[model samples]
Target chain A: MKKIYLALAVFSAVAIVIGSTVLSVSYEPLDEVAERMNLTGENLLGSPFPEYTIPGFPCWAGGIISGLVGGIIVFAIIRLLMKVGEDGGN
Target chain B: MHIPDGYLSNKVWLTCYAISLPIIAFAYIRLKRKMGKMEVPLFSALTATVFALQMVNYPLGPGGTTGHLIGTPMLAIIFGPDAGIVGLSVILFIQALLFGDGGITTYGANTLNMAITASLVSFYSYLLFRRAFKGEKGRVISGGLAGWLGIVSAALLCGLELGLSRATFGYGLNITIPVMGISHAVLGLVEGVITGFAVYAFGKYKPELFSR
Candidate 1:
């Protein structure tokens, strides 16, 4: 039963993204057809449908490297804080 | 969100795992220390509740952002940080495996972001606020503040991670980071309220939970 809820949530989220994308695509061409109803390009990209393309290898590479490095830094900081707290007995 | 397959480079997932291992081990040790055989049901039930709640997502404009209210920090305030981490990780794991909310590979990163960070931040902030207020209200306020801060903090850190990935991959950090960050901030505010209320209510009803 709970699993069903989870599935529904994930499905709806995906649907929302897809619906937004469809709206954006539909609107993108409409501007050319009807400039007066000009729903701005920025709005199409920013809200509802985020502008996402298949990122090239560069984006993937950067994200991986950054995620690992940042994770380490955060881990170290958290460790230090924990050690201090343990020593302080709090 | 679950990191979809191929959404992130292998290095990112590896790094997240590398960092998460020790923290997870520590959490396990902490849980063992506090565990009572009878409490398993209570914990599992709580985990289910968190998972179910987090699954519900309200729409965000054209894009839909839906999920539980994200109350990890509040859990930590009442159940100690390490135990809090355990509870959160369990929910994330269940979501990934059962519901497919997050990607399998991205589990490490997602756990680190949602559970590890929020739990610790809430624990520490609560301590600080408890000292500042020097009373019961202090505890309540701390719970809410920590809950709010924990969610926002996770959102910001997630943005930073995304931005860095964009930079490393040459995806144009200028575009991805701001977009992710702004969306999360708006979402986080709503999440924060939910988290804050959860913590405040728990503290009121079960003050004994926060006493420790």
Candidate 2:
């Protein structure tokens, strides 16, 4: 049962990826799609890219850094609070 | 809100990453220390719940607006803030890498907003309310109330972050915060109800875990 469930989840995920890819392909001239959706923003490289305007940045590098950095800081703050709470308990 | 790629400035994103690394390391250490007998079942349940909750994106308002429950607070109350944070971060990371629900660049920011805030706020709220209400009733009420408050706080924090992004990028913060906050406030309410009920149910069935 668990295996079947896992398989279904995997298949669903793959289907979503494929579906998104196909949607992006069909909507190739994203400008038209953007106009259709009444989206206003800079052109970007994904299905909903135009809907969400591409803000100015070193896009790829910024994304990696954001993921890495934001994850770290939140983790640190959580630890610090835990320490404080423990000290208070003591 | 799942922050898509190309929404934020690169420099700001990197800066967030730089700030997060050491913090994540410290959190990992704490998580290792706190893993006890019930931790596995608790963590497993939380991971499944968070993933399931995030799958249901309710309409916020108007066109192109929707919000999902980022279930960190409920996890924190059950597992303590440190473990909850670590666990949720892992879930977020996996979601980014595999599912692509959120931007790769914004995972750090998202993790901080969802897990950190939810866990801390919910944990403290539960602690405070746990004291006020006595016995079985207290545990259920406190659990539900804490979950609601924690989720709302996370939403507000996310709104604040969005406002900051807009300001830093030369967009109007005034326009962003209201849209973001109001939408998330509704999302938070939904999260609060479900989470509160879940906690209440868990306590009712397994009184030993919640009981003092």
Query: How far does residue A54 in candidate 1 sit from its true spot (Å)?
Result: 29
| lDDT agreement with native, every candidate | 0.54, 0.56
- Sort candidate 1 into its docking category: incorrect
Cα lDDT for residue B23, candidate 1: 93
DockQ of each model vs. true complex = 0.03, 0.05
Question: What's the residue-level lDDT of B100 in candidate 2?
Answer: 50
True contacts kept of 1: 0.00
Query: What is candidate 1's local distance difference test score?
Result: 0.54
> Could you give candidate 2's per-residue lDDT for residues B102-191 as a string of tens digits?
567766666666777778889888989988997767877787788777766765665555556653333445755555556556556766
Per-residue CA lDDT of model 2 for A1-90, tens digit only, reads: 244235434533433333323221222121222244454433133432222112464434333333333333334443443354444543
**C-alpha lDDT of residue A25 in model 1:** 27
lDDT, candidate 1, B55-164, per-residue tens: 33455422453333565776677667886787777666544543344556667777787888888887898788778875656665666677767765665555555445
